[model samples]
Target: MKKLLSILSFGVIAFSCQQQTAEETNAPSVSEESLKAHIHVLSSDDFQGRKPFTEGEIKTVNYLADQFKSYGLEPGNGDSYSQEVPMVELTAMPSETMTISGGSEDVVLNVLDDFVAYTERVVEETSLNASELVFAGYGVVAPEYGWNDYEGLDVKGKTVIVLVNDPGFASGDSTFFKGETMTYYGRWTYKFEEAARQGAAGCLIIHETVPAGYPWLVVRNSWSGASLYLDQSGENFQPDVLGWITRDAAIRIFEASGQDMKNYGEMSRSVDFKPFSLGLNATVTVKNKIKRDQSKNVIAKITGTERPDEYVIYSAHWDHLGIGQEIDGDSIYNGAHDNASGTATMLGIAEAMSKMKTKPKRTVVFLAVTAEEQGLLGSKHYAQNPIYPPSQTVANINMDGITAWGPMKDLTVVGYGQSELEDIAEDVAQTQGRYIIPDPDPGKGYFFRSDHFQFAKVGIPALYASGSYEHMTKGVDYIDSLNQIYLNTQYHRPQDEYDPSYWTFDGMALDGNLLMEVGLRVANSEDWPAWKDGSEFKSIRENSMK
Candidate 1:
């Protein structure tokens, strides 16, 4: 059973700090009972995995609105606590005959087992009628690096097969890109976007377990179901087809096309490579079960006493994979750690702030968005259609998956060195007797994985940070193993159900306080925070502010 956060009165928070003096700043006091209550209720079996376009979403959104009202906040969307995000969900049913035939080869790759594909265009039907295939190396065209895979090639209306990750990652060259650490160019999203910009009829990334990070099972589980995309409103440049093919299946397909993975894979890592035809004609006829609906983004705000227009936003995604493919007799993807924890953690901070004696000078928003699991669609929609101007928003502090393990001595900032937020974070962490560290695995490209990236794309400074590295009992090694185990077994699986048996509340509280402190400092100060000088977002920020 889940316990409730210690409310001062029924439906009202009583725990408010008078001032952030030296003593108060040294420790954070987020209620464990409060955190547990939010998590258990949100992740309960009755919620139907908290998926959108279902009963689960209804309960989740209504509950969040009620919570926001109870916490004495104003509805963020003018008089409504909810913002309707329009989306076009497509469930592509790939035929068995979807194949690449040419070079005397007849290869019919099985769906899910060998590849996964979908369309980005807002259409019920999409087809690739034997589109000519081109091997476009890594599909990158970075002018800064003087690298162009499609240097002399015109791939218009042709299907392009690209390698995952950038050249530096493939070659392990320290001087190239960011060495083993993946750059924005290495992400599969970048690959697909680039292909579409290059006028490709279809874009398929060849997936290798190591370079792609997760195994093929992850891809199948994530992309197999009803895929959601922002209604393009008839926008072009998004490819007719976007997908991934497994490494083993890629090897077989390459050999049939009179090539081999070793030769092409090596060639992709070199900057001297040029795009060439694969001698194969790729074909796919997609039948989409289309659904159009609006997902809810539960938003409310604690209006600032003075500068309400200048806002500080707190975000947490509230959507997860609904009922789908069964695994070991379980069907619902609970998403307990993936985001229920994050939602709860954000709520705890809101509750704590509600009872404070002094509100910040700038406004603070509590936004629990939907369809994040569906490719950050909800946040993407919000960024594109923001309630307030992006320039007025000081920062977006996104919490996605708060560490439920025991206490730690360090905080792990995902995008560690991109902004001055890290500097502020370092200052706040020191008082709590915790050091700040970058994500140990930068090669995974986690910085671009969460909803914060959406806000960052629009020039808003965003922060996604977590803790539980140096455990109060065991050390860093122990914490690392626990994270690995969670990813391998429970992440995005039905097994992610809430289990308080061995869960720790102090970690969540501490992380929550750290986030609150970061926001509190930003909200209270007259000085605005910004992206660091050499950061990619620096110019974007400069332009937006101007």
Candidate 2:
């Protein structure tokens, strides 16, 4: 494994700074006011939460393209600044009652409260009658880890209620499936996918705050709206019904089957665990209002001086939890910090590149994608079918939520140990007296949750660095507290609106510059970054680069 930069190399930081082309008149000053201006417009209430296939998306993409034009940047896709992403919007409305019958009495699970169900199959009425419920422990089937939660257990055409996260978390065994640091198997998406692979009719993950990393409220708000997915002509690669049930609901159902959920959770952590047949059977009926439309990905390019073909990408999702459930009587989700901040930062960096006196050797593309709140659909589409082919794309630096409390003393590199891009982040962070830290909670599997992961999937080394949690004014504890507050109160809620009083651009401003500098470093470099040891993407990168 590659060790960190030696302490003696700290003095070499100034030497590294000398290689930068910042002295050129073209190096544009990225200002806090400019960042605020972009955020104000994009996250404004007028944008209607920036939901795709709505007026919000139209306004968001147009404004982004217009800004790119005003900044004197060229269109990224063909001759147009916009690239259409055809999607099928499904507003699935479940029946009021989901009956789970087993013992003497039948339990009627409430929709949007107890569980949320969805089917990607393009059908008018997708209903399941008396689907047997199977408790499949963690619901993971990885041969590499000698794990198969469904080993010798047949769950085909059954509804499997599994615990969220992985065995390592429940058992607190570090050697078992990455221990606290969640592998991809710990991700909810992986659980659902594995169920589909096993031919399970339905999959419902039991939601626990510690393991899932968010309160059940977040699940309700996020899952209770119109969901957007890529319009595919082939077979839908998803379960007939995928859902999440509150921990309370899972416990009640298990108890009805005479199994203590408290002990059942403990049993899941063991490799010898077997599937429990919950005598309970599930009945589901879903009615969906489907709307087919095309959303645009706003693409703007600052072409390189030398290797115009080789590209460097800067990305940020422009979608949020859209106008959904009300909070304090406010329906607008504003998404000011969730992504409006990242979108603004992407724009600010692009603007800086536009004013540069010297263009780098590789082209830089700024992509503000749509339908991110729907599961990074926009970036996935771009990765699968690129206007700029993924092979030519050198690196992707994605900006998501940037800590806005104030100036920070450190930077947290998500997927920190996965690639050499962290080296670039570390080098730049040192110049500003800021240190580099890995994602504090890898068990959340945040590395796979963002747009950069899509790029990485296609063999491109991608960097997504979260803003420092350690603040200069209040210390790291205060910063962590603020993050928890955002998670509990503001995230994905109407309260996530912009407010200069409680937020600041001091730290975000520096972050934007760091993104720009990192991109410049890669764009101007002769060698491409390689995925580091222990990264699943390493072999893929090596093969693709070869």
Candidate 3:
């Protein structure tokens, strides 16, 4: 018996030694040249902005597939690296006429400036004629919070007018619902989803640039295009009609009702907030042309040597504003920093992992999702219908809106406290002589906007760290100014086109390296990362593990 025990112990030791040797040999390293090269191709004008459902998407997917093949990545879906994502494109034509009523004075809402409306259903035309308008305050119905904006109100045939952000924002008390941090409740997606659940004929969210963190022009451009949605196999959560009313337009409606819009907006921030009865009504006639279209989720897999069933996913959205109305002379909304940097980094990581001699213990999935700028649709589809079982999936590392200004002394983890993945990132960051910082503006709810949210919703812990505001070389003020300049002048605009003269890709290389290190730590770990305590995803992930 002792002899047999000795032999067993010896076998285990030998196997352990072999595993360590393999890991040491196969660890991936990010190369400066590779990072710059990938970004150059992805941000190139020839790609036409990488908008999905167009010829641009075709080229973009093929380019990724070809790169993955060269990097020795196995096909993510059976024999193909592409996953077909069925989508419906609904285009709401510019409204010819719109009106407001139920007020002491008659009010006419102007198109382009006042409101933007679109149909959720796949229809050629849907009209909201003299629809009853209800002041649905925050438009939220969180049973946990004992809040219901639709309480005792039958909004079946009515257009619900809701406030932007959560009541906490208006309340200004951190004790009330996540303080200034925008909860999922503050998200526009949630507003429309909740409105649909309440059976509203139409949903209109009042837009405040500060709360929305984006201008009305963003809505105009995004909604003006052929809005795409996943062809939900069955009944999905979508409102009958969804739209946004400018703050000024909302004020006009309130003024017509002989009420101050500013005062009502102020009341919306209170905890005991109730839907206001804005003695005002509205009528919308939406003329939309719906068409079925198809897009692809570009996927590539770096097969594991031992734990092939377990996986780590790195993702970024590839689609952007295709060709929008010209801002100046340029028309293509070249989403360079918005996501071109992200997609490029994803490709960069794939290259590094492919060059490694030793394969990771777990499979590494690289996904370049589409239509994130739309509403996180591409990643959402993948989460609902993943190619791999969610149980074996370990974590997701996402990249979006990478910095082009310069490298930072710290890495900002958006949704910083949401997951255990942050610890892994910190360890990696430490190795690079950097540290991790919480999101500078949690009130923005930026954590919920990107593709990572889709995975997080389905129980996969995801990381969203990027270069920070504190530049490694220059001061914070310089970096802030440059970033502000980008936001005001180029971000999401045609001017976002690549400018080699201005962009210092060496900074991108540093970011790509840090991200690559984070992925490596997860790929080699036997334990799966978890959402932090109190995170909504924590319970979901725990259940999924079961």
Could you say which candidate leads in lDDT? 2
Q: Candidate 1 residues 1-546, lDDT tens each?
A: 122443223113112221242235332356889999988998888898999898999999998999888989889999999999988888887665569889685888888888888887767789889999898988988887788888888889999999888887757677787777777898988998898888989998998877787877788888876878777776866888888898777787788788766667777877667788988888887778889888889999999988999999999999898788898899998889989999999999888888777787899999999999988888999999999889999999999999888666788888788888888888887766668999877778888889999999988999998885777447789988988888888887888888878787878887888888888889888988899875788898889999
Error of 1 at 519 (Å): 0.6
Residue 35 lDDT in model 2?
89
> In model 1, which regions exceed 4 Å deviation?
1-28
Cα shift from native, residue 343, model 2 (Å): 0.4
lDDT by residue for model 3 (6-110), tens: 756754653354345335546445565766677677767777777877777888888888988888788899999889999988778857546898776678877
- Model 3 error, position 383 (Å): 0.6
* TM match of model 3 to true structure: 0.93
In terms of lDDT, model 2 sits at: 0.85
- Estimate every model's Cα lDDT from 0 to 1: 0.84, 0.85, 0.80
Full candidate order by TM-score, most accurate first = 2, 1, 3
Q: For every model shown, what is its TM-score relative to the native structure?
A: 0.94, 0.95, 0.93
Off by over 4 Å in 2: 1-21, 24-26
